[model samples]
Target: MLLGLHDHWQELCHCHVSLSIYLGFLGAQGKFAYKLLNDLFANYSNALRPVEDTDRALNVTLRITLSQIIDMDERNQILTAYLWIRQVWVDAYLGWKKDAYDGIDSIRIPSSYVWRPDIVLYNNADEQFTGSMETNVVIRHDGQVMWDSPAITKSSCKVDVSYFPFDGQECRLTFGSWTYNGNQIDILNGLDTGDLTDFVENVEWEVLGMPAKRNVIIYGCCSEPYPDITYTLLLKRRASFYIFNLLLPCVMISFLAPLGFYLPADSGEKVSLGVTVLLALTVFQLLVAESMPPSENVPLIGKYYIATMTMITASTALTIFIMNVHHCGPGAKPVPKWAKKFILQYMARLFFVYEVGETCKSSKRQPKVRVVDGRTEEGGHQPRVCATGLCLCRHGSLLRDVEYVANCFRDQKAAQKRTGEWKKVAKVMDRIFMWIFFVMVFFMSVLILGKAI
Candidate 1:
């Protein structure tokens, strides 16, 4: 009985060892089995041929995830994005039962070994691809093919800069199979919506949203509709940089334009100051133009700049007019009565301008004179007319000379008064204009900045 039991135990151990060796052999065979894959390919004449008949549609699904926005050129109307493009489709010929080869579930194969859709971007701007196209293809036991590739694609995008630096843009990447029509290739969206959860933020732009759409187009020449996938990227510009560097300076310069009025007309620098500020504004405008694409509708900043320039030009012209008024000499016409009443009396008082009493008092002061024997004595010693009647008769000339001298003095006094009045009128005008310019600048600033804010 003991011999029999020991023999039974030995047989059990032998059976366990044999089972282990057999399992090891099966595992090794499962790993080294390329023969089955080779057999499958050998049976097919062209691996590149799609499983569907040439006339029947081969449904292909697409999934895209944007990784980054490499660059967007407004001037060139180009958009460059780094994307992971995934193409999923089932190849009926490549399918094999999992039980056929020790439950092999999936395989990684070269993309050249299988059929792939000839997808191309309809609006491609670059002549050559920005990334490598050679990649591995994943195949499941059920013949589901997943071809994922990372690409840096550059495509044409129509740019509208009407509201540049504060504007939002919509750009599209349209993809379609180049050689297959909708009848031959049916493109489907892989996800319910284009996923943007993995999108990397850009420094100059912020992604508002991304939406995907499928379109079918029937060309006039072709009877079949072509399948297309369009991904629209909505982005807004990050305006902080432009606002600080370009807009702030322009606004400051515009404010300074009005300060030119503070320069006294005698300084001869008002025109030069205005023109310098005008040129600086022009340079800022050029900077804006260089940064943005040309468009028929003006940008908000451009409009502001133009308005500022208009104000500056008007101020310069007014400066020139004021200088002319201030420089009027004795030869010029006297200030008009209405102008004196309105500007010198009413407007000057309204603007808080004080009348110059010293000039008026000096002009009104009369020269001291002593009359001797009914004749005026000049310089306290020289006699203007002789006391003798014979002298007067010899020169009724005496009366005529005195009268002529008196008229000369009266004309000189009148000219002095006219010159003073003209100067007062110029001062009044300058005050009025300064107030006008101040109000204009204030209103313009509010309007422009309100729009920007």
Candidate 2:
């Protein structure tokens, strides 16, 4: 039984050795295949393009995937985008069938070992910016070259801030072959639209959509029509930030004009409030100006701010005029009958303003009569009875005293009349301006916000 067990163990060991040899051969074959691919690429010259027919244009297709919008500089009119650019073209010299090469379907070689189209952005702003050239290129067995690399592209754009903050911008990136014209290279879009599957959201801007188009243009200088692919990226400003930070504050400051009217003329703060609000509006205007690029046409927000400032300034001047009218002294000309009737009677009632002098008149006290030694007298304790049964003071003192009281009454009436006239004028002015300001604000709001919408 021991001899029979030893023979079975030797047979198992021989089977294990045969399996190891088979695995070794597979590994060797993989190494040989890799070596063959390397040898083939070693003799490949990237400088030599495989263009058999110079007249037949090399069909190059472009695909771009927007990874992120690094920044959009409105002041400089530059758009910086992070993109994954893929370019595909056919190279007849690199063709090899899978049947001729042990079923090798595709191989990756250094990008320098193949011919590549010199695709360039016609509107590129940064001359130093270039796509990554160290990435590997994939060559299929059917001679199709697929090259993809990350590019930090900076392109110039024409910015129209006419409706800024709520504006939509269409910026384009045009790609075409630099050296080879339409005869030698024909560029086409690989996708109907740019890929945004991996797009990174921006804080101040949002991507609306991207559309790609191909166009052929015949330049006056060049007879061959140059083919180019254009990718248009539609971006809309994220206005919520600007609205909260800039616009809301401006609107609030504009409303301060009404507060100036609420301030009493006696407090001497009406003009000051109006001036302060005007300055605040000016500061906001500067802030908005700093955010937008300088252009011949004013942006919608800027125009609104300017109109607001003008209104506020006019309101301030009107406040000053109203204060002057309220403080118009007694030395000035007496209030005209027509002016008093219109401002004091009609406008006062219309504005719900009460007359100060009328209240005082209704509550005025009568002159007290006092019993003297001889008789009753008005306005004086000492008295003498005359023949007419009226009290007369000694040495015509009653006459002088009567004249003095009459003079005092006259002066009080004049002062009260002046105060009433000034108050009436102020009230009328305030009411008129309140309506004016309301209309101004309403129209301005509609004009500004309507354009944004």
Model 1, CA-based lDDT: 0.79
The 10-residue segment of model 2 with minimum total lDDT is 355-364
After TM-score superposition, the amount by which residue 408's alpha carbon in candidate 2 deviates from its true location, in angstroms, is 4.3
lDDT per residue for candidate 1 within 407-439, as digits (tens), equals 788788888878777766777777777778778
Q: After superposition, how far is residue 142 of candidate 2 from its true place, in Å?
A: 0.6
Q: What is candidate 2's CA lDDT for residue 357?
A: 50
Per-residue lDDT tens digits of candidate 2, residues 280-332?
A: 88888888788678888688888888888889888888888888888888776
lDDT of 2 at 410: 72
The candidate scoring highest on TM-score is 2
Best by lDDT: 2
Model 1 spans > 4 angstroms off: 1-33, 45-48, 52-55, 129-132, 356-413
Task: Quote the lDDT for 113 in model 2.
Answer: 63
